[model samples]
Target: MYQFDKRIVMTLDAGGTNFVFSAIRSNEEIVEPITLPSNGNNLEKCLETMVTGFTAIKLKLPEAPVAISFAFPGPADYVNGIIGDLKNLPAFQGGVALGAFLRKHFGIPVFINNDGDLFAYGEALAGALPEVNRMLQEAGKNKVYKNLVGITLGTGFGGGVVRDGELFLGDNGAAAEVWVLRDKRQPVYGVEEGISIRAIKREYAQLSGDLRMLSPKDIFEIAEGKQAGNMVAARETFNHAGEVLGEAIASINAVVDGIVVIGGGIIAAYKYLIPAVMRELNGTLEMYEGTSVDRMEMKAFFLDDVADRDAFLVSTSRRIMVPGTTETIEYDSVKKMGVIMTRLGTSKAIAFGAYAFALNELDKC
Candidate 1:
């Protein structure tokens, strides 16, 4: 396909372990994306590297993208355009003036958001939340839905909340830190520490006292086969996870009633474990006949190139783009890190995409 008047938007997901960048032309079509190992040990040095890389990517733009949206693996004062003390990302602890720095250099608007928050917002705008919402709407008058909770289990767990169609970050945009599950039973450890994939492995091994080593994948396989020792161990460990997860969700439900959507590699291993999770959640609910325990609805998202998944591209195009506007086409099949975001340092592109989205929405207001 050939085109004229093309507009490019770049998005970045700078994570602790991996950084991915993607360039989207009108949502579906990708011009390029790149991925790289991240070394966020030093803030100024990493930002410097990012700037250098972005310069190179600009040379290949299909006519400089309209905006950029960046997702950083840290705490950010999104309203003020400052990165706060991100515990996992030591380099950005004190805070980075990402917005001013980008604007002075590129003369383009940029937007920043917490990766988990953006992930959930984008999912609702474009991915799994829609499916879950549809199911709730079907549940009819009994439905008490008001928000969207996204739980992602990757290197660690990522929690995000969406209320009334917008990312609800509370005063500081940190409302979705649901991984900090306080288990009185465990006393010392939080939920992430006790039930994350890493924790599950340690608990399983310690209880079994098996000298033989096993990967998390192996644990799931053993659980699937219902093997005697492994099943007993797996059931015990995962049931604890479900209980912790249920508690977290129940607490959130008290504040903002909504469906919980759980994703991530670990959950993929044992899809059947949700039943145990739902059972545990039932114990937490104090229903008086009318309300009863129901399975928490879950959905999986594209694990790769998540930065450019265009959660709102389809909806935006349909609502805003002109009819017969073949000049711009959207495709969601390609799965690769954007060139600028991953290798050439395209954090600006990400910030730009997000800014564009925010501006567009603001205009509708």
Candidate 2:
């Protein structure tokens, strides 16, 4: 197994707008980063830019980097380190064999993964989950949360899952691709239509009936400033998004039951989003509450004199009733699943994740 202590690797964070290059050590310390335009429309220029950036960073390091690792947006084969038909960068319509190409040129092992997956992995290892577990320990709770689901709300919605401290890629490296799931209310639209920056604007426009193209930031400013006519629309938009997100989380919890860490530019307005999400989740818990038959009988006896006994029984039937126990049953609730913002910013999280992933791969060799 490779010892990660003091080891350094070349890391890249590729996005639609820019390619950020830097050297990061095992301890998550990052060196100066060089930012270059992604040259996204031209594959040749994009490849050249990445090579040039890494070469420059390599020259500055005292020792050659042990490997190269990066987080790339995907619709491609992450297992094979190929990027497929990136919609934003049309020049990559013919998939790029990124890992092999980089390894050949740099003469080192190269690792690549979906940006969202790596972001979640970083949070699981060094950011949100660790912080949460620490807090749990400090508060004298025996429970430690290891699984996590991370979501990014930017131009689009992206999601990833981590289980037991490792990224969960599922059978085809597409386990947590939550954005593609059909929307609960609009079957024609995917979940991303309700969770993205565009979604926020669409909701605001629908609510306010003003079709002028407005960014999420603009809507946020109006809402935060309590602008008379626009605030209600903006607030409703966020709250609706949150409720949709909560439903998505409930579905995810049914499978993974993990904590959630949210990131991306949209999270700047988390103050408006989180409460609505919590309210929806809490409501769902109440809706699914488990009760005992004895407890129901006790309630029925107490309410027999009441005029509204039938209505109370109808409401009580919604809860799952266990037999032979008058005592209140303590059922596990979904609300126990914590949600928090990412402690590590996007770039740092991606960079550190790439570095850690590279090291883990090296250890196996």
Candidate 3:
């Protein structure tokens, strides 16, 4: 591990509504953060705001920052540090060469990445995955988890994958864009249509037959109230959201089987969402059981007893013939996978992720 105590980097969390600035040490210590309105509609003002925030932090530092890193939203080129036209921040139209701009202005290396991807890297390196690995090691399980999927549920559903201790950006840097996957109910709509804050409001409205504007927090409050009808509606909304999320996760698992770490504002209602997600995952395991069987088959031995080998293979196969349907199905063996709330919270996780990512990049030089 790099010596984090001796390294500090300037960090920015360029959120949809706010531009939060801070400095983070490799040790995961965060300096005071300043939050400012994004002013996202005006590109000039947005750039100026970022420069001003970094300048102020630079003035307070005993030594100049080693590098600058940002956790930014994206549909653009993360590898090149460019930001595409963002729905929330219209000023970023036509894609901005943000990394080059920042590097030129600050005279230091600058790195930028999608917020969801950075969050996943942070949690895997310093948060949930590490905690889980420690516990498993202490329990003498001889297993350590190094792969994880991170999901953020807020204005939209965001996803990132970390495999074998490295962030998986895919060939085109659009690897974990889970939101675009088809929805279960309406194939025309993507997974985000059923899992985002808007989805919650839409579901709640349909359930209650009331179309009044309501935030997810407002819906959660109603669920906690004594009104039976509203409570059921609210619960059902979250339950459906969880089911959608679980389905998306299972699909991702087919490609990369690992624990999932969930974060963002909506996760505050995890108590209501998790059970529903687990229920969906339990029901949908059959869809991915083939992958699990393949893994188990890799361990099967030719020397095993004839009956024992057959029975073991049959159990792993999980194949069942459908009654009167000329169809067969496979069920998963209830593989141990975890879905847990993030321990680092959102902001700190992003900050630490920025710091860690900068260090890794700088090391290459």
Candidate 4:
């Protein structure tokens, strides 16, 4: 399904509830995306589902894909392509050698990384950090150095780090695993703790004595309307999580002057809880006169409108790497062709392609 003239890269972000996949050509061209239920029983089911998805993608491409990349949930051994134990995703425990399997089956290079790290990479490469840096430079401040952090408040807290414009994977690849803190200790000490959606639901059931909740979305909606007597508890829960996040950012700031690029479904309630978070952060960080903490300086990303900005960033990056080539041409042509693949959405496909592209690039090193 791939074309002789076009290159293909696949990326996937496997979550607890769902697995999102994308096949992109370069940074701009999206080749469609596939979504399937995430069965975490083991690597077998995941591999089966992925292979099937790849087959479907092949039908539309002109030739075999050039490379593959993945952004997997939980702790990932990116340097060696081995996955670590993930709590919610039962199937991924004891690690998965995803790269070796993909290579054996497809005869192509494959690269994989943590989902949180990919999000951070995208943000640092294209998101809030770039904008902030450009603004600072234009104002005549020595271009702010690249110490960055990205946090995702989804099924649980996910975090990643970047320093000097590159992803900083520590000696063990677990450098930014900040969400594993225990709830009681985290709340009191102002440290960020990762709270699963399931935990929130359990809390609601305990307080209201109703065990028939449909989804986190429904629960939050009702709580927002104050229809379920769940608003108080939900607000407390979110605020506590936000406080933890802010405290963590403060700790991170002590070490690096990086912007915190936040994303994920849980961040949807950002507006509701950011105030408390900001308050806690300010309380802790007020003494540091050099840290930037003003309203204009610290801005949260709105995923709705700021959507494909990451695509633009990635495209720009691809252009930078390939000098003398008109970047616009690559972006426009690839974006047009890739969007033609399907209707699933951009994030899935872009992540897939980006992952694939990353793997191919790493192989050269």
Candidate 4 stretches greater than 4 Å from native: 1-7, 16-19, 36-39, 42-45, 84-95, 137-142, 182-194, 202-216, 285-360
Model 1, 302: alpha-carbon shift in Å?
A: 20
Model 1: which ten-residue window has the lowest total lDDT?
Answer: 336-345
Model 3: which residue pairs collide?
none
lDDT for predicted candidate 2 compared with the true structure: 0.75
TM-score pick, better of 3 and 4: 3
Q: Pick the candidate with the highest lDDT.
A: 3
**What are the lDDT scores of the predictions, listed in order?**
0.56, 0.75, 0.77, 0.58
Q: Cα lDDT for residue 134, model 1?
A: 51
Candidate 1, lDDT over the whole model: 0.56
Preferred candidate (TM-score higher): 2 or 4 = 2
Model 2 clash pairs are none
Each model's Cα RMSD: 12.4, 8.9, 9.2, 11.1
Candidate 3 structure quality by residue, lDDT tens digits, 1-365? 33345777998877768988888775555567888889999999999999999998888777778999877877889888899989888899897999899999999999888878888888888887886666556545555667988888898888889998788889988889887887766778999899898899999999999677888888888888933348889988898888788777777766777767888999877767877676566562223445432321112111113442233233343677899998998865534556668878876676667788888888878
**What TM-score does each of the candidates earn?**
0.69, 0.83, 0.84, 0.70
Q: Which of the predicted structures, 2 or 4, would earn the higher lDDT when compared with the native?
A: 2
Cα-based RMSD of candidate 4: 11.1
Model 1 C-alpha RMSD to native: 12.4
- Sorting all predicted structures by lDDT, with the top scorer first, yields 3, 2, 4, 1
lDDT of 4 by residue, 225-284 (tens): 745656766666566555666656656555555566666665556655565555554552
